[model samples]
Target: MPTVRVTRYVTPLREGGSLPGVVEAEDLGTYVCKFRGAGQGPRVLVAEVIVAGLARLLEIPTPDQVVLDVDPEIARYEADEEVQDLLNASAGLNLGIDFLPGAFGYDPISEPARDLAGRVLWLDALTANVDRSWRNPNLLVWRGVLYAIDHGASLYFHHSWPGGTGDPVRFAAQPYDASEHILRGYAAEARDQDVVLGKRLDDDALRSVLAEVCDDWLEPVPGAEDADALRERYVAFLRARLDGDRGWLPGEGAA
Candidate 1:
């Protein structure tokens, strides 16, 4: 990912728990920056990079991401006490998503095409993402194109960490509850998309996707000795999900 220095502290986007913000970077570009110091920590950032890469591979539309270098000094000029504390805490590298001006929240009333919706559902299932419900769809309609966003909630296994990393097979066997998914009706198409997209997510492809994640965010847990180990763990988990008996695919037998 390209690195950009944050030039100015902009307003806070108070939509979610993490409290991501809109900011201006040295490249004269505006971004929605997700801070490392947020409640979810760097793990969420790691999920964002991995999922974004997978989205691109699946031909899903998404905003560009960059590594934002935040300076501690920028916090001094902040007027809001809450925003000031957040900026001060996030004094290092953060994840910056290219701001999509005027993009509106997704309206399920006018759903996406079957194939596109299928692909989105497939991607979410493959990653064990549980956030894309009707209550809070992490999708945006930008200029008539559906774009996936806020993927930090995907890959839930990582939250369990050291203990969870030990069993990739278990995660592979895990079933995704797509009944609540926004695009649940497109299950048949999702199954078809799985057959196609699944083949593309081979070992090499999975490695390439994992490569986009920053080393710092791949912090070693108790089970994983180093960043490389952690990367391998992620790859193994994904590959298992793709190659194993995919009961996780939402449909007739889906949970």
Candidate 2:
């Protein structure tokens, strides 16, 4: 992944609990950065990168993600004590989601084509992402293209790693309820692409996407000694989900 140095803290996006903020990078690009020091911690950042990588492989439109090298020194200029604490906590690498200028939040009134919407629904189900609800769509529209964002909520299993990274069999067999999904209206269309889409997640493709993830982001956890083991765990969980069961598929894999 490309690394960008944060030159300035633009503004805080207080809408979310993680307190994400817009900032300018050395590359002259702007990004909404997810702080590694946020209450949610670096796991959410890892989830963001892994899920977005999969989205790109699945041909789903999403913001470009990069690694932001943040310096705590910038926090000194901020007036808000709360914001200052957050900046000071997130001292090193953080996740930077490309800021889409003029992008509008998604609404049912401007739904995408059935196939595109269904594809998104399908991807969310596969990842067990529960964040794409109508209450917080996390979907954006720019230039008429629907883009998925804020994937930190996608992989929830990692939070349980304090006990040790358990076997992925359960995650693979897990079922996803799409009743509250923002694109639930297109669930049926998503079913049609299930088989074809599953085929695209071959080992090679999965590895390619995983390669984009930075080693620093893969914090070691029980059952995974090193970053390579951590990557394998992610790969194993995904491959198992694709091959283990279709329980997570929307409509129970009906096409």
Best by lDDT: 1
| lDDT of all predictions | 0.89, 0.88
- What TM-score would every model get versus the actual structure? 0.96, 0.96
Query: Model 2: residues >4 Å from true position, as ranges?
Result: 252-255
Q: How many residue pairs collide in each prediction? A: 0, 0
- What local lDDT does model 2 show for residue 142? 91
Task: Tell me the alpha-carbon RMSD of every candidate.
Answer: 1.5, 1.7
Tens-place lDDT per residue, model 1, 68-131, is 9999899889888888888888888999999999999999899697899889999999998899
Show the colliding residue pairs in model 2.
Answer: none
Candidate 2 C-alpha lDDT tens digits along 29-84: 99999999996798899889888988887788999988999999999999988889
